[model samples]
Each structure stands twice: as structure tokens, then as C-alpha cells.
Target: MTRSPFTRRTVLASSAVLASSTALAACGGGGDEGGDTAEKIENPDENINPEGLPIVEEEITISFMSRRSNASAEDWNEVAAAQTTQELTNIEVDWGLVNEEAAIERRNLLLTSGDYPEVFYRTGVPSGDIAKYGEQGTFIPLNDLIEKYMPNLTARMEEYPALRTGLTFPDGNIYSLPGIYDPTSLGLRYQTKFWIRQDWLDQFGMATPETLEEYQAYLEEVAASIEGSIPLGGQDMGSILTSLYGTFGLANHGNDAGLIDLDADGKVRYFPASEEYRDLLSFLAGLYSKGLLQQDIFATDAAAFSANGTEGLLGSCGVQTPSGYFGKEGDNYVALKPLVRNAGDEPAWHAVRSELSSIGNFVMTDKSEHPIEIARWMDFWFGEEGAKLFFLGVEGESYEEVDGRDELIPELLEDKTVDEALKPYVLYLGGWYPGWATDDWFRGVETSEQSTEGSKVVEPYALKEVWPAFTFTAEESQQITTIGNDISKYAEESLAAFVTGDRSLDEWDDHVATFEQIGLADFVAAHQTAYERRS
Candidate 1:
């Protein structure tokens, strides 16, 4: 294989190379001995020469990897290479960016082969993976190191129980320092928002459809049958159709703990077997036959979806997120209002879901020679200052103070696009919508006037309920993980069959049964258990 000079993450499940193999193997142990790997300090007064850190002039390389979407590791890619390094810690970094596909392969090869770097950057192993490796003696336990060094990181972990919980594994020993951000984000960015094209509605002289039945009537007319614009556009990954289920008052479609919600009193039943799901199917099926359904709904990516939303192609369609749909037109789409009930029936929308992380499952490798150093750097990124540097660029250059606040001053770029002056300098937060991570990251990156001028605006029609069933527990995690993998595959297949009209609602019973047979109950139980535990 031609290995990209990027992250080499190939999954190799071999033994983690450890120093004491015979004794450890004889003892039949793979859990943390919970002992510090640092040389034991017989007396802190004598042995703890904790006075100084390595100076910037005394250079050492930190070879870390990220599962990089961009693929190439440029010279300026190192987090510490920016001006803030000299300003804060005075540490110079050598960048070794790696590709993710071979991440596991290299990780296994290094740990088993025993030629790992002094510091493993972006090892690409999960917490469970950490536990497995730590138990194997491939990873050093971080309990004492965290206590002795990393006071700033320790302060935040002590403050947030969740942070500590995330870092510490099954045996009460810390493995990897978590890539922490604010536990509570401003709000859930990944949400379902139903968007209607103001232009299409205006062309038809139609008032915004409020109820599901009314919307259906509109969609049917627009379905290219009765003579309006194409009423729907479909994409598989996007959950616009999921809104059909949401209209029936189901919150997160994927659930465990119990599919049957206990009311303020109490109740029990399964969701897939519910009448709401049935109605959703029947209505969608009807739309499909009428040619009102989106043909490419199952295949479209986010870019395609955004094109439709921005281009005003349909009368109304499914979009769980409103931000992209709203701007450009600027308050044109009545995005935040409640949809009316279908016919004379009740109107219900899914509870607003929160707690979606920017990245799923940040990982660490077992080849860390300086776990404390690595953890310290990661913890700083989670803290107030590090968060600022990562999100916003150096102060004054990117932004200015205004009315007791830091906000971006609008600057036209060379391309003549209207972007904040700071945007080019500040490292982008992958795909996360702006103002996420640290609100403090905004400080001095912009002027108050500019910040206030460019403040976020949401459609008035957005949903208004909190669905707290977000986080999953360890036991529940095992089940959810299993089901999630299967569910995605099954969902794709089932949705395809339905969209093609090869399968009808007549076979809905069989479909539900199939899902259950594939461990739907276990999945639901896990999510429910996690929800209750976290709550």
C-alpha cells in the first residue's frame, strides 16, 4: 500500500507491547495496575526537582497525528506554530500530520512493534481502546501525573464531574486527557427545521401551511401532479422525512430506556409499533405515488441539500437545521413557528435535541512517553485561554474592543466576499456553526459593534422543546453502538426499498419485526438507561 505521509490508522488488534510480559501474562492481568510510570519519588523534598520546564531554545519534537480531512500536513498546521506559542508557553513544534485510514494499522504496528514515538500525537484510539491498551501495560496511568503537574487542567476536571468521568476509565484510573469543550453548548446546532420556499408559496398565493394535513395538501399540489413547483426534495442522510415522525410528537427517533414513554402518570408501548409511525409511513407513501416525494432524497449530500434550500426549488421540504436555510434571504423563511396539526388532529413536533459534539469519539494512542505533557496541552485547549487561541486569532490583529466586548470587524477579502477580518486568521472549527466552543474565544478577536451587528438570528418558527435523552451510558453504549451500526445499514436498506415503492406499508409489520429481531429492544433499553442515569 502506498502510505500517505499523513495519519496511518489501520485497525490492528494485536497485543500492546509492554515491558513486563511474562509476569503480567502469568498474573492474567489486563486492567490498570493504577501505578505511576514516572520514577517513584522516595521523598518530594529531595526527588521532586519540579522547578523548571524545558526552554524553547532546547528543542524537542512532538509528532502527533489527526484524522485529517484536509489530508496534508502543512508547515503552519501545528497548533503551537502560530504566534501564541512564543506568547504563552514558548514551545516550538515540529508538525507530523498523518492520515486516518492507516491510523489503526500504524498504531497496532507501533505498540506491538515497540518503535513508538516519545509522544504519540493523535493515536486514534477510543476510551474503551485506552482501557484495553492501559490494561495491557501499553499505556501509562495518568492519576499521579495529573496531580503533580497540570494544575490548570486539574482545576477544570475538579470543577466538572462529567469531565472527570470522561477522562477516567473503568478502573478509576485516568488514561487519555479528554479533548474538552464546554459541557453545555449554547444550543443544539444539529436540529430538524422544516423550510418552505417563500418564493414558491408566494407564486401559489398560498398562506404558510401550518398543519400536517394542510402541508400534505400543499405538497400534493406541488408534487408535479396538480401543477405547482416540485413539492419535495429528498436526501437520505438528511432527516427531513424524520420530521414526519416528529409531527406525531416523537422526540429523538432513535431511543432506548423504553420506546414507550411514561406520561406524567405512566404508560408503556413501543415506538416503531405506534400509530404515529404508521401515519408517517402512509402519508409519505401517498406522497411518493403522487410524485410529490423527493426522488434523490436518499442520495443527496449536505451541499446538495443546501443548494435546494438556498435555490428555492420546492414548495416545502424537510430540513432539521434552520440556520443555513434562513440566512441569505435574511428573515424571509418563517422557520421557527409551530406547524399546524394534520386536518383536525393534534400538532406535535419533536423535542429540540441538544448535546451533539463537534467530533465523535476523540482517541489517544498507547505509545505516549509523556502522557502528562500530552494531557497538559490537551487540557489547556479545553481551558479559557487555549480555547480563545484556537477559535479566535491573536487579539488586535483580528479584532478590536468595542463597548466592553470583542467582536469581528467586517473586512472585505481579496475575493470581494464579506467575511469578518478575523476569519482568515482564526482556525476554522471544522463544520461547527460559529460562536461554538468558547464564547471567550471571541474576546478581542472582534469589536463589540461588529459582533453586535453580525449577531446570529434564528427564524421565529423554530421548535421549542428540549429532548434531554442525548448522552448514552457505558452499558447502554455497548448496546447503542451495536444497534447504531446495524441501524444505519438497515435504515439505508429499508428506506431504499420504501422509496422505490418496492416495499409498501402493508409490509410495515414485517419491517418493524425485522428491526426488533436485530436487537431494537436492546438498543432502546441502552439509550433509556443512559438517559435516566445521566438525568
Candidate 2:
């Protein structure tokens, strides 16, 4: 078997000393008096199958730690997906459920106190922590385990090499498994888009905007013609601004304070200090001044945005699907093509979500007693049977196959929405999980035709080369966190000020200078180093 370059033995050998020392300290001593080490559970050769189910002959239980949704059942054993998986694999799970709000603190406490469950599932552990813990031997490296035990995932990695590259750390080891998706799939590629009121466009006899000027002109007309209409209404100001950044030929990179991206020359550039960001802010300020944008865009919540849309007061908005805000009335809205800087210029970008999540979805700790069994157990999710079970639920219960398509039961959709109806059975609806996502489940059952069409409308213009999930050294990660938190808060506040005319754009240069003084250059340099290393 061809192993991933990320699993090279040379890298592991080099770090063995550091790992051993850290492991010893974490265990409180090196001798027998120290904490228990992971033990291999002996199973009969006939009991284990590399590519099939019933992973173990006799049923075995493993401890899993993860955050649970408020709507989900309190016990994992009661959840439909868990129950089905246990039946299929004959591997029971002892779940350690954490409340969503307390997940982060609890995760940190476990890591710090050296008290770990056998596995972490859907805990949203960041890549940096994965690297830090993997190096310290708190989280065991999964490279060899993946190659040896996870044949389904190994085939997937072979088919989509990017999946392996995306999940590998700098030390050439994989510490976690990500929720995988097809990169070219339209549903994942164009997750959110700028939408316009087709009814309002017809009301004014205006065509769909093709360029920035036309887009602004349409908004201006809507402000002048419609009574009490918000030309552009959005609940999240940051996301709304991100949607427009592409028109100015900028990649909507990073979250919060780490707003760095590669330039035309592939050099890292901090966006808040860039000339393109300035132009975008200037255009937005003009929109705010002209009463075309929502008056309380910064303060508007989802409920308020939905209320405005329900009242037919929004002429345009940014959303994953208009149905979320307008219900069936969303049919009046149409997904607008990504507007270009000029009439003939190619659209540069749109909202895109990566096929792989940035955070660790599933990981095994050093204390797992049955590492091989656990690896095989986890691999089930990447195969057809497990994916179907996790995504669609039981064959007849959650969904029924109709003419080769998986469709939700009519009774589930009668009074409740698709999500509300499915929440009781599915563990994480429209959220991240530890499995491969199928386009069949997503497009056929999860989304509506309107939403799929909306994604298709913007699919051609979506950015092809968005930033990859980068892994940083522990020192680099700490520097980024320390500097990024302050920078992100400042940038958001400054953006609000500039748009609302509370802060003059004339002082934009000083704002840029403040960013520089606040270690913007260092932040970009650190990211650049990581990008170059990954390349």
C-alpha cells in the first residue's frame, strides 16, 4: 500500500524523544506507578474484517467526548444514528456529552488535566491544539492507523489526494479525521450567495445586475422607489462585507482577526490594511449614506432579518437560501450572479466552504484501550453503509428510498420544517460531524430545488483557489492567537465605525498604521511562512 508522505517514519523518529518526555511528564512519572497506558484488546482473527461490518466479534464499548445540540437526546445510546451504528458495528459507545456553551472550557480542562476520553468526536478541536497535543503524545497520531485500518478512507485519500494534504500536520502526521465532501460539488462550493428580490426587480423593470455599478444602481433605485425598503438587508455585517469583497477582486480569507490572504504574487497580505479593502469600505459607506443599506445592519439579529423579509421590506439580502428567511415566499427571490468589477470582467469570487473542515472532527487519545478496533470503528463512517446511516438515518424511519432517491417521510415534513422534523433523530443537522458527506443526501433531502438552483447560479464564479487549512507550529500558533484576538476585535470595530460614518475614512491610513503597529506584519509573515511550508 502507498502510504501518505505525511506518515513518513523519519519525522516520527525525530520527534520521539520530545514525545516520550512529554508523555512521561503528563503521566506524572515513567515507572509502573504512573498512569495507565493504552492497552490493545485482543480479538480473534475471524472477528475483525478490514472492509466489512461487525468490527469486533464480541461487543465492546469505547468512551467518546463531544458537544451535543440542545435539541438532541441526552443519551447518545438513544440517538438514532448512534443506535444504528452500534447495531451495525457491534461497538457500543459510552458518550461524554458536553453542553455546547461549556464545550470549549471542558475540552481545555480535559487536555490540561490529562484526563481524556478514548476518543473525541465532533468536539471542534482546533488544528493548533491537535498539533500541540499530537506532538506531546496526548493525542495519538493516526497516519499509520489510517493507512492500515481505514481502507475506505484510504481509498478516499487516494481518490482525492487533497484530503490527505489538508488533514496532515507540519510534522507529516495526521492527528484527526475531517468531515469530507466532494470539492467540486455545487452545494458545498457555493454555500451562500447574494440574492435579490426578483419581484422587486420586475416591479421596477430592472435587469439582474452584472457589474458593481449596476448592482449599486439597482440598490439606489430600490431605495428611491420602494416605501420603507432596505435595499440590502443582512443579519451579519461581517459576512455581508465578505460577500462584497470579491467584487473588488479580493479573497474573503480568514475569520475574525486573521484576515490574511495571498496577493496576485501569492504573497500574504493582511486585508484590513489593503487598498482593495479600503475601496470596499468606501463603497459601503456610500451605500450607508444613501440609505440603501439596513439602518441597523450591525445590530440586526436573525429574527429581525426574518421579520423584515417576511414583511416584504427587504429588496436584497445575503443568505445560504432565501427560504430560510422568507419561507415559501422565498420564491420571489433570485440568486444574483457574482457581480464583476466591470461589465466584461470575470467574477473573481463568492462565498465558499471547504470540503474539509478546519477543525478536528474525530481524534483518538493516547489512553484508548483498543486503538486498532477504534480505528476500524471510525472508518465505518467513510463507507457507503455508514455514510448512509449517519446521513439519512435508518432506511424506513427517517427517510424512504423512492425511485433510487432518498426522501424524507411526508409525516416528518407535515407541520415542522425539515430541520425541526429531523432534529429528534439526527445528531447534528446542518452541522459538522465525523463522516463523509454525500451530495445525494445534501442535494436530494437536505436542500430544496430553489436552494440548489441558487447554488448553481453562482457555482461558475466561485473562487477555485481559496486558502487551505494551514497547520502551524505551537509557537507560531500561540503568536497568532495572542495577536489575532486583539486585531480581529479592532478590525470589526473599525469597520463598523467607517461604515456608519462614526470614523472618517480620511483616517484610514492611520488605521492601517495602527494595524501595522499591532503586529499585522508579523501576522502576515507567520502565515506566509506556513503557506510556503505547506506548498
Candidate 3:
């Protein structure tokens, strides 16, 4: 067997790697007591070509576990992209795909039953689980694997330091790969947005509101004029209220206590405890009191919200895109700029999700004998050519170059009776490969009239400052899981009560005190330590 240059030196198991010889023997200890030998299959010397496609010279079978979407081909073997990839790379993957609905349960069962695949693709492992499994020797650390066999991924990490930082565990080893993305895309550039009914504004002979006062007046006027319509509709109170909180300079996401950030003096401060947050709650309470906001703001279901939007019963909404709920009726909605509470204030700060936002897209388990081959196979997808294949599919078949820009042809997107047009290409489109979404992809490409117009309406309002999704150390992770969960639940419950007038604003101090009592200080300290360590 050929040894990989990236052979891991550390103990494959937990801190008890140096346990008694009897115990080690019981655990199938075969290598150095402290360091385990790399598990490998027969090396295909000719197949180790990193310079070209068909990464392995001969056919190599690797088993994979992934969550299957309805859009994906029922049989992973029949997926066009899977077939094409095999044809190109000679990597035959035996896929065990569970439906998305049962994926997590199935994944857990597979892991516990000792029937897990050598690799997991697409179905990301959570941070806590990654740390747990990595420590338990269930998942192999990939830092060494990346350094030796993954030039494409290494180059990307170098380009975007966040990718490496976000995926790295507190133990100073990486456990999984991330789905890298180009953040310059319009969709990647922003997350939460405010969309208003332009048709309503036109009918009422009113202009789009720019300031908080103007927005309040507009909502009031809409409520007074329209019958059976909500002035502001939202999926939840959090989504709608975050827009208000943004204007007040507290970029709060709902239910987070230690979504803490550095204040002007560079000390970690909890935004929810700040004066701005109280003001936000009060403002929302006033809106609720006036019946301008949706009555069922605290409801878990978004069916009513979507139904209202589709029926043109909503004046404005906080949504990622109007197209999601409004469909063709989305044309009537236009994005609202982040309203200023007052003139001369800096841009409003919404919680914008980063495009490099994935926990653990791919992982190799101890069952793998050909980890290097697996790394090489996945590395191809991170490269320029592979990105084209993963996202756009076969150019001439699924997409075509229109005036130098790659666009999915109408045949796959339009020719069918309705949404069935893309069924023929579903396999190609649904093929799983961990990589970046390129500018040519739909999310990146802003060619559509709606996308172009939506960008114009919302881009300028995007905040310069963002709450970075920082990776946590093991200690911090443990503390957050304990204290943070409690604080989040309290915040969510209190937010609903305060906004709905069930809890008095006078009780705000008591609520802040409660957060402190529930280990808020420890939560903030953990985040602060992580932030400074990263710096």
C-alpha cells in the first residue's frame, strides 16, 4: 500500500489514546500506541493523476451517504451528472440516499448501527455533532487530507480565509468540508429584505417610504384605507421586527442572546440588552396595538402570511424574495430600502447570512480506505471546470451560452406543462458535489428583470457591518449549548409577550436581569474569547 503524504500523526481516538494495552487491544489497536496508521486500499498508482480529469486511472468504487431531495433522481445511479462524472473520473459511488424528511434520523441510525458509508455528501453535520464525532473517532480529521490531496480546496481556503476558519474545530483540526460560494452575487450579498406592494402604493398615490416616520405613516394610511388587509405581513414577529431593530442600530436575529458583537469601544456587548432593542420592542408594540401588523405574528405557521400575500392582502412584507410566496403576483411587490429612524444615521443593519454558510458538507468516516482518492474526487468539484458541471450541468444540454452568458435554456425550465420541464435534467441538476456557486448560476446571475429590479431596490440599503458567523472552540461550544439555548428560548417568549402587550415594557429590566441570571455573562465571555482568539 502506498502511503499518503498527509497521513495523520495524532491519535485517531479521543484523549484516552494512551490507554492500557488491554483496553487498546480491545479497541483494535494495531498501529503506534499514540498515532494510528492511515487506513487504505490497494493504491492505483496510475490513477493518482491530479493534473487531469478521470482522477483515478481505473474504476474505483466508493460508498456515499446523502440526503435525497424530491427534485433529485430517485436512483442516484441513474442521475445524468453522476453518470457523466463517473464517465469522466472513473469514480463509481454507491450512494445510500435517504429522503430529506428522514435524513437526520437515518444518518444517526446508520452511524449507531455501524452501517455508515465511507463518506457523507451534501447532508451537513452540525457543529456540535462534528466536534462530538471527531473526538469520538467516528469521523476522521481532514486537515492532513486537505494539505496533501486537495489543491483545489486549499486554494479556495487561501482565497477565502473564512472557509477554513469556519470549518476548523477547537482542537485545531478540520473535520469536514464546506460548500464554498462567491459572495459577490446579489442573493449571497444580502439575506433579510423588506418588500412592499408597489401596486398598493400606486393605487393610493403614495411614494415609497425612506424614513421610519414615513414608513409608520404609510402603514397607518394603508390600514385605514384597505379593507381586510394587513399593513405589514411577516413570516414571524422576528423577521418583521428585525427590520425595525436594524434601523435602531441593533442588528438582532430573533432568539439569540449572545449574538454579541463589539461595541464602539471594542468590548463584546449583547445587542438585545441595549437601549436600541427596548426601543425596537416599543415600536413594534405600538404597531401591534394599532392593528397595522399581522395579528398572528407569533404563529409558527406561515400559511396565512403567504395566503395574504398571494391574495394581495398584504401591504408590505419581510421576505427573502417576493417570488417565493407571491408567485406571479410577486411582480406587484418592490423591495423597500432600509428605512432610517432619523436622517444622518448610518445604514440599517440586517442579519445578512454569509454565502460560506455551511456546517459540514462532506465528511470521511473510519470506514474509508481510500481517503486520498475521495479527497481528490471532491477537489475536482471545487475547481473552475467542476463548478460549471455541478451548477450549470452540461452546457449545450441543460444550458446554452446566450451572448456570452450561460443561461439555462427555456426547454428545461419552460417547455413542460408547468414545473415538470426540468424533470429530464433533474439528475444532472440534482447531482451532489460540494463546491462554490458561480456567477453563471441562477443565484449569481442577475439577468432576470425581477432580479435586476429587486437588486436596484435593496442593494444600496445593505449594511457594511455584518455579524460574522465565527467558529467556536470546544469549551465555547459546550457553554453555548447549555446557557445559550436557555437564553434564546427566554428571548423568543419575551419578545412575543412584549410585542403583543401581554408583558409590560416596565418589565424590560427584569427580563434583562433574567438573561444575566441564566449565564448571559458566561455566554458573552465565551464569544468574546472566540472572537479575540480569531483576531
Candidate 4:
């Protein structure tokens, strides 16, 4: 909700608009990698063939697009995130990155117009898009191709059968390669948390808040008693509170019923009209009227809000992740307690949307003849070694080791220390995950002059749980697009108006009615049906 330099954008560098063709001819029967047959990849550097499966000798460029960072585009710098396939499998990536905003339209143009790439290179094609394209003959179903060509990917698929199911269509064939969102995927992504200034709390003799009433009371203290700051500032998670109406808003998942859910089979469900949402709305309206809520919290960008916060100007604000949202500078901050609205509320977890439904990323085209070779090449990106380089940076160059753990180097933290090293160096330009990022990825540069000081500032702390829903179908997805879009737009408009005194909670009943009229009912029904099918 709060904008920042690191913030994900609404637009993308879409190039699926171009139409062209390339051919893939089968090479000799795939041999053991790099001309080695009997030897196994036992050592990190020594192990090459995916357990004796050969490296793709074919030199091809699979052009693709993304809504997020394509570090490859940044400097053509060889960081682990993008270039690992070249390093290990000898596959060259001819990447075509698009801005996030125009990605969908561009993707549609490229495929429908008869032009296609070898594959979606770690592209974030959603299940619906995969299904629609597969149905349209634009995407090749991957079962046989994967079995024949991609042992490593198949092996990973076998390990996570749920992923196999999630990625599978009702017709029972998987149309696209899947990116399994694992546990470590949590702890860093899409967590909506309210950060309160500990230093200010100490100054005002107020303890961290754990309930809605206490939160309100805390804000009053911040506004009236504190000299120059608004009592609280929060956004993003605003939907969670907005849904409850007044009782208890956990502000996780989409929070609004009919927006999203997990059915018996652990697939995504829409839950927009659930009674719980009304309570969230009422409570937020009350906060808006009381001035305990910072009216501009949602309206403000990350820089403005952070500028207010870095100097300790505000008491509380909401954020996606605790890491850089408040500036991850060692243990300068800590979580107080997860909050619940009202006095006798029960504790609840934010829904798994944080992990599930990765908004669109890199995907390949359907025109290539060598699906196996392309898939195999893509497999190397997540290969064990590739995972390490993409996440850990260049190992010895970006990091050092101590006690069998990766740490930062002296030069890495010479400037603002950990912050400078962690941003472009360790993350975007040179990320770590090639095959499968192990727990070791978190242990950055363990043996350094600033290792002692930087680790304290750089260690990961916020909390996020992976969502269960991954592959919602095309039909179900259409329903989601129709209803969720309408409701979300209305909710945002209504919420801002209420907070700014353009409207009042006295008309809360009408707001509820309008939400239902906009097909929130249809949204929830479609999601439930899809959830049952996925299950």
C-alpha cells in the first residue's frame, strides 16, 4: 500500500506483441552431461548432470517476460538468479522482459498471433492462463515431454505431489512447468504487519498492542500525548480490518470472504460475503472517525511514510514485510504481538495468499519443438547449484563461510554495511536459487569483519505462511476476475471515502448491500466450485 523504490509496479515491459518463429531440431539422444556417463554429481562443483541426466548441449535462447525484476536485464550481469542455466546446462537465455502493466495483453498477442518462444522461462503464467492456452492449442501439455526429458523436474514434482495436483488441469495433464513455493518462501514475502515504533512506545510509557481496543487506545496516546506524530499509520492490510466490519479483522489472505479461501483439498476458494467481513469494516470506520487512524496512511507512499518514520515521527504503520519496510538495520525492531480486534477476540492466522498465487512472472512461448530440451534447460535454473548461486550471490565473491555457514565479505558491508550488500548484490542482481535453495541461503556472508555487526542487522525476522491455492482453473479464474475486480475496486473507494469523512459508517448497511450486488455472491460460489474440483 505504501509505495517505495523496492515496491512492485503496476506496469511491465510487455513484448509478447511481437510475432516470430524459431525451430528446435532433436539432437542426438541425450547423453550423460558434459560427456560424463558413469560419474555422479556428488560434489557441488563436481556434480553436473542432474543425477547423471545430461546437460542440454543445444544452444538456444528462450525469450520470456516478467512482472517483477529480471536481474538479467539490469546489467546482463551474471548473477545466480537468471544465468544459472548457462553456467550449468549450457543453455543460453534470449530474454524479452515486459513491464508488469502490459504483460497480459502482450502475452495474449504473441501466442494468439502464431508466434511463440521455446518455453516460458520461469514465467509466472497463472493456472488459468495455462489452461486456456492449452485448450486453445497454444500451450503444449507437459506430461510426456517432462517424463522423457526432465528427470530433475519430475523428481521435484514427485516430492511435492500437491504441486503436481495444483498444476494439473481437470483434464488431468499439467500444461505448464510449476514453481513450488516452499517454506523458506515464507519469512520474507507478502506479510501484512503493523510496525509500531518501539522507541516511541518506550518514550510514551505504552506497551505494544495486542488487541483492537488496545490499538485504538495506543493511537490516542500517540496522537494527543506525542508531540509531533500521528498515533498510527497503516495500509495494505487495511482490507483485513475493513472486512471484519467491527468484531475482529486478522487482515490476512484477501480477508474478505468470496475473495479467496482453502477448501478441503487445499486449493484456493473465494470467501467474500462471509459474515466475518462485515465486522472488519465497522471497526475500521470507527477508527477512521476517531482520528486514531492516520487518514493518509493508505494514501501516503513508502518514502513519505518512511520519511515520517525513520526520524521516529509516527507510532504505527502497516507493511508487507518487516525486512526493509521499516528498514532492516539489524535488530533495530521486533514484532510486538499479532493483533486482534475487540477485547475478547481470538487469535487467527493470516490466510496463505501470501505464499499462493504468485502474481505473473517469467513464462515461455508454445512454439518450440524441443519442449524437453527447453524444460530441461529451465530445470537447471532451479537445479541445486543454480539455486545456490541465484540466492547466495557468487559464493566466495559475495559471501564467505564460517562454522559451515555463508556470511558476508568485508567489502560487501563497507558502505551502509549490510543494506548496500543485501539489496542489489545479494538479492536482485545476484540472487541464489538455482535448483533448490536450502536453508543455507539465509545465512549471508558468515565470516566477515562486519559479520558480527551485519548479521544482527541483516538476519530475517518477519513471519509469512505460504498459501495453499496455486492453480485455479480458467473458468474459475474468470469468475474471480469478474467479481473480485469489482468488489476490490468498490472496497478501496468506499474505504478511502469513509476514512477521509467523505462517507460515514452510519451507511455501513448500504456498503454491505452494494458489495453483494456487485456479484460478491457469484465470486464466492465460483471459487467454492473450483475448490471442490481442485480437491
- By lDDT, the best candidate is 2
lDDT of 1 by residue, 279-328 (tens): 66666767777777766666677676566655555555555333343246
Candidate 3 clashing pairs, residues 3+ apart or interchain: 47-57
The order by descending TM-score is 2, 3, 4, 1
Overall lDDT per candidate, in order of appearance: 0.47, 0.73, 0.68, 0.49
Residue-level lDDT tens digits of model 4 in 262-321 = 544454433333345545655666776777666676666667766665655566654433
- Ranking 1 against 2 by TM-score, winner: 2
- In candidate 3, residue 393 scores what lDDT? 65
Give the lowest summed-lDDT range of ten residues in model 3.
Answer: 2-11
lDDT of 3 by residue, 1-535 (tens): 2111211122112113423422332343121311321534224355567557777787889888888877766786765556777888888988788788887787766765656778877776667667766666667888887887789889988987767767777788788887655666665445456878787788788888888777888899889888988898887876676556568766532222235666667877777777778988898888889998888878845787777788878888776677766778877888777788886776655545555656566888877756778888888778876666666666687777889887777767654422244444433244333677645664322324455466556567655444435567544565566666667777787788888898888877777777776767877887787667766
Error of 4 at 401 (Å): 2.1
* Models, CA RMSD each: 8.6, 7.7, 8.7, 9.3
Clashes of 2: 2
lDDT of 4 at 242: 33
Candidate 3 accuracy as lDDT: 0.68
* Model 1 residue 238 distance off true place after TM-score fit, in angstroms: 3.0
**Candidate 3: TM-score?**
0.85
Candidate 1: which stretches are off by over 4 Å? Answer: 1-61, 71-73, 76-83, 100-131, 134-192, 221-228, 234-237, 241-245, 252-275, 317-331, 338-353, 356-366, 402-405, 416-424, 427-484, 521-535
Alpha-carbon TM-score of each model against the true structure: 0.68, 0.90, 0.85, 0.73
